[model samples]
Target: MEKARGVRTERIPLGKLEVGQVLTTTLLDEKGQVLLAKGKQITRPFLERLKARGQEYVLLEILEEVEAVAATEDVPLEVKKKTLEDLQDTLTALSQKKSASIQPLEQDVRRFVKGVRDHREVVIPIIQLKKHDDFTFTHSLNVSVIAVFLGKFLGLGEEEIRLLGLGALLHDLGKLHIPQEILQKSQPLTPEEYRIIEKHPVTALKILDEYAAIGGRIKNVAFEHHEKLDGSGYPRRLFGRDISLLAQITAVADIYEALTSDRPYRKALPLFEVVEYLMGNAGYKLDEKVVTTFVSHISPYQVGDVVRLSSGEEAVVARLNPILPFRPFVRLRIKRPDGTVVLSEEIDLSRSLILTIVGEIELQSQIQVE
Candidate 1:
């Protein structure tokens, strides 16, 4: 495995390490001298935070260092720029159309769909970093981006991805009709008030039905995305095949977006936590197939990202191997007593060791809940 500067170097065992000190561990066969194993040991300080919060694992990443390393590498800047522009334009169009009597931004939606279809991972960070305060618009766009990529991963054709994007963008259109007070409330809603919120899918279906151009599939997706596989979800409690594939995909994407985002009720869960939540709830609350696709496509770490290895060693994600989603080659970003950043040699977490992501630090600003 090729290594980069600032990536992690060792994997430590969580059970053998002290709280404050960083560690490195390996995940190779029992012969530790020959090959490294994949796993990490958590320092007590970080572990205490998780314990206090009644949490098990935390996802940790140093955003600035990761970006610094990535900045020095060659990226398809033109493609990234174009995709971000298209995403911004698409979001703007959706917002405008929702507010007025304008026609659906079909072409803009197409561009958004295409952007996601062509380059998903590269564009996701940009989308997640959007600072817009309009929760409805931004949330819709995020859902669309997630859904399109997921659909493509599921072997759906381009046309399906386009439709999925439209469905996602409009999934919560009915929320526009909700009272501003209830929608933007800072506290949990009363049981009666929560019931009203649950009716949005039905409301959205009614709104979409008015437009003859909106077909049955898209309408169903909008109305059923909240429904679950075990008949535990809202809007008629759909189960199994009763829910369409688009609805299933939307459900997974929507929940993911919602969990990763800040809300009045709570702060966002870290990325690794989000993954664990989904993985834990799969089949019981989520569509296992869709969850698999999501887990497979998204990397736990992006290039240049600084992470706290399971071993407690701080490192950067130098390279990503498509075959291993959990482990990537890393370079150690050792910290000196003087607070200076030092670079160390690289290690392949996947091959040399079985390093796990225990936690992550979310760097983006918390969006105002609405």
Candidate 2:
């Protein structure tokens, strides 16, 4: 197993497996495809399932230091750029009426979803290093990934999750038809421009209609992803129970992707604050159940992220705790008056009754953490 700078990897056979072993590196099949990902804390039932599948070995993470290793991109940089370029090409073709095939887009989405699932170590950080030019395509991919996780959490079937993935991926398809100047406008939009923006869902629905290969239910995301439960959303303002569940989930994902992305007008919001916003929007704008399920899948405290505890000492999130989204296992770094350093002190927050995290250790802002 190959080890990165501060991370270590150990391969163990199924018979030697024990619950609670932290996987720092993803396990791969003989063909090198990821079978299981890092940050997945081993559990008895899960381990038993792995053994039942005849899996022989797995590579797990071992910590070596408290160094601030840069967050790795979930999808490799080259892969992401290529995927975005392909998505843009597909969008251009659809807009020009040269083709009605969603095949290219679908293939990319499927590849991306599988990549993120296997590379859980970088799922949340996938968008951290995004180029501003790739925002639209990357946003679609990110939302699709988040929706896939949400669907699985809600016990949806694989095909249903695929539909959700497609819906989230194309939720903003209508935006492609809008004028570029209006879409990328740096200033606040005029009423007319805002009205035009509201029509994207309907516009996307029309485009999806031409492609009979796309599922009818999947097309609803284009029509109603913006609809609010309170009847405040535009272009047909269907309220409460009227919106489809897929559209509702896509709506939450849409809001999240938008808020966390850097826009022409503002910076991305910190993840916990965004989660707080989603929690607040439930019942009024978003489906409460879907919102609850969605947040559980988001890994907020990323590995290598330095954070401040309620106790006033600072620490780095040296490891991730799969069961706890916010509280991960942290390695404490204390500095003495003589400029000496102390490291190797690890604390698993899952078992800690005290030393709660108050907020991120401001230094994390200096580096982009997932």
Candidate 3:
């Protein structure tokens, strides 16, 4: 047996296991190789095979139960709901090749820009309104929200922020022309299909040309959001200085939103992984200034969120660290003998060298354990 922080790892005999038992901790073999991951259900066949292999004991990292806390909203839910509805209508009209007014969408962008300015200090949380069927529209809204926030953080003027917001909102307008089958395919896309996908920027530019009311800057965002600074991105393959600053901002927001949101191809990645990706691509592929500003301002875990610590204990996010958003102050949950969970003293993770947040605890999982 061994213990570190609040976490305990113990060797339990295979005879103690039972069929249909769901494992909350990973089961490791004698050599410390993972035999079964956490959250997996033990079965008779697996236990029989382990016994046949003369495996008498397995290691388990015992985790404590903690009550899940609901997330508090930084952006107004009403604004997101209204914007989604208007975007859906506009996209539907454009897809059908009918005349559509972007006035409603313009108003939506203004409201979002104002919201971002008002809540400048609040850490933005992941939007939970994503639906597989409404991915295009929801993605657009998320991109717009992030872009507007980034623009404000970069100290851009109000008019520029609004235009950036509007452009981000309509950045994926070309997707409306893509066939639903190709867009929603769960399997890997072939080269031909990928080529078709790469044409979205060009398609969007063509679509935007019809709207004389839309300015060149807004059109640039739509057409150049996918272009990278390294000349590796598709379409025109433009390098640094060629891509507009607004497009660069939108590109950062677009990648963040897409990777963080659940997609048809894969599950939503953890915030830490997404941030690492953005950091890795900072100078070579993405704008260094935009990426740096984004990383410093964005918090992976929001206040009131329930997260699992490296110690195997669960904690609630108490406060954010402005300089290091990843490391924040957290209140650990103490499980009492009577099964009641209580909050312990607030621990500043930035000062603690041994403890770190590993992952989030979903409300459903907490309920199941309780």
Candidate 4:
């Protein structure tokens, strides 16, 4: 394997790899041949080919400093961990028809709402670094977090925000009933398969009906989040104002989270493209007020993040622009052949029409080998 300066290598079992996961380092075969380039999203076909070649393990270049800044900036790590654990326990119990208490989940929602209220700037990094096995739980957590952020931005009451958070957390509860093979299929789903997928919302309602504590607003969000403003959505195609505002908020969050996240079928779309999609669907498929509030306030990159520019240079996010979320102030980083790094003056991307952020650099800090 070709070794880069200041980087370490580790061998990982092929069986542990998941489709749609983006590796931080270059992947190499056991024979020291390059298997996949670093920073590329893994695909199902790649795994299949590796298995065909009788490869049981692959080597990865691990940057020592990457984990320090790996987690999303503002969200507390403990809250995220507890939420995931509670969500798994709650959902598992519900699916098995065993008696379960949502009190833990309720506490989780309170924490998420509090987090959203405390952080002035909220950013949902478009590239989801998640495992394929727990995607449903992770996706639900993300949606709830985003929904709470939006709820606070929209001036919702504290109790309302809590309801929205709890509802969003359980939005995809019915996916547990769906077949795993269909959910994990990398190929485009057939129409029949899609029909089955659409039934998840109905299934979720049936499961939720057992809980007396779940309010009508929360139930509405669980069932109607898939419904569009334009009468084109699934289950019961209730149009326009028939959909509650809380459900509308969850829908916006759900769509944004799903589109920005990597799926078994495709890689995650870029942040710019995802924002444009939300804008395009505003007033038609999604609520205009919710979309506008989300697009205007939610940031794609946080301060201190390293990003790649369209011109091939790298820069650090110095500040965020509230009005123009996609455009932020960035300071350029220049690396010299003599193993030194230089920081340039900050440039406001909103003012500079010539430059645009193309992608985020996964490794936040890089060290030179002496």
Write down the lDDT of every candidate, Cα atoms only. 0.64, 0.72, 0.82, 0.80
- Model 1 residue 368 distance off true place after TM-score fit, in angstroms: 13
**Over the stretch 220-336, how does candidate 1's per-residue lDDT look in tens digits?**
888999888899999899888899999889888898888877876788787778889998878887889999878767755566666777877777766665545456667888878
What alpha-carbon RMSD in Å does predicted model 3 have with respect to the real structure?
14.3
What does candidate 4's lDDT look like per residue over 178-274, in tens digits? 9998999999899999999999889988988998887788888889999998899977998999998989999998988898778888987886899
- Segments in model 1 whose C-alpha atoms lie over 4 Å from true places: 1-104, 120-127, 310-312, 334-342, 352-370
Q: How many clashes (backbone N, Cα, C below 3 Å) per candidate?
A: 46, 2, 0, 0
Best by lDDT: 3
lDDT of 2: 0.72
Residue by residue across 188-305, what tens digits does model 3's lDDT show? 9999999999999899888888878889999999999999999999789999999999999999999998998777789888877888999999999999999988887787767777
Runs of candidate 2 exceeding 4 Å displacement: 1-82, 112-129, 308-314, 334-342, 350-370
Task: Identify the superior model by TM-score, candidate 2 or candidate 3.
Answer: 3
Please state every model's RMSD to the true fold in angstroms. Answer: 11.4, 13.3, 14.3, 19.4
Off by over 4 Å in 4: 1-73, 122-129, 363-370
| Ranking, TM-score, top scorer first | 3, 4, 2, 1
Point to the candidate with the largest TM-score. 3
